[model samples]
Target: MAERRTIVSGSTFEEQIGYARAVVDGDHVHVSGTTGFDYATMTIADDVVDQAEQCLRNITAALTEAGCTAADVVRVRYYFPDRADFEPCWPSFRRYFAGARPAATMLVCGLADPRMKLEIEVDARRPG
Candidate 1:
């Protein structure tokens, strides 16, 4: 049987929502949509760019715990409440994903929390 594991960031949202932050199944890691709230203090930034960077930090932590890095990412999705907020975060995205250059998409949509300017989800494969 293929090995499977779950990685948690200790965000109350994960327990409240009943979902793991990331799941390691065989060679693939599927990270759940993660927000900008620092799982430690549960505080989020007011600026969209700052929120975008925090979202990457949150996702990177989950990926690390799952035995993969952003460089291993194969796909990524960005969700934003405002399309205008997306451009301001491009530099942050480029910094994190320049190497992986993972397939990417951005969507404008509502989030669970109005304070959440952006959410990010990623899929990665462990180097074989």
Candidate 2:
């Protein structure tokens, strides 16, 4: 049986939403939809590019705690309210996920907070 574990990022929303930042089950790590807010300051950037960059930082923290890296990521999901904001973030995407080349999906939709420009979620495999 796979061992199940939960990772917390200490974001207030995690407590309010009643979910962990990520979960590790056996060899798989499933990260929750993470926003641009810096967990340390809970502050987000106004620019979509900057927000996307911060999203990577936050997701990296959760992935590291789950014993994996972006290289191990198998799937990724991007969420943004504006379609135009999505294209500008491609460079930031390549910065983190270009090498991994994981299966990806981008959604144009509303986020929980209006201040949030984007959110990222990922799934990674733990290497033996």
Candidate 3:
């Protein structure tokens, strides 16, 4: 069996919700839907674009911990509470994902916290 490991981001939500920020199984890494809250401060930005940028930052940290990088990401999913907020975040998303060019999808849906404007999830493969 491939060894599976969990990566914690020190967010209280992880403990309260009973989930890891990311999980690594063999060569694959799956990052959970990450919001804009900075785990250190537990605070989130009000702007969707800012939240999107922060989400990528958090995802990047998890990927790095899993021995991967944005370049290794093969798939990505974006969740937004409001459809109108999605386009405002495109530049931020494009900045992080242009190189990877991963398969991507965006959905307009509700989030756990009303303050959260967006959430991002990604799947990556550890490089050879």
lDDT by residue (tens digit), candidate 2, 10-124: 9999999799999999999999999999988988889989889989999999999999999999999999898889999999899899888999999999999999988889999
Model 1, which residues run further than 4 Å from truth?
Answer: none
Lowest lDDT 10-residue stretch of candidate 1:
61-70
* Candidate 3: C-alpha lDDT: 0.93
User: Candidate 3, which segments miss by more than 4 Å at Cα?
Assistant: none
The residue ranges of model 2 lying beyond 4 angstroms of the native Cα positions read none
**Clashing pairs counted in every model:** 0, 0, 0
Model 2 residue 39 lDDT?
88
- Model 3: per-residue Cα lDDT at residue 120: 92
Clashing pairs in 3: none
Candidate 2: Cα lDDT at 94: 94
TM-score of each: 0.98, 0.97, 0.97
Poorest 10 consecutive residues of model 3 by lDDT? Answer: 86-95
lDDT (Cα) of model 1 = 0.93
Model 3 superposed RMSD (Cα): 0.7
**Clash count, candidate 1:** 0
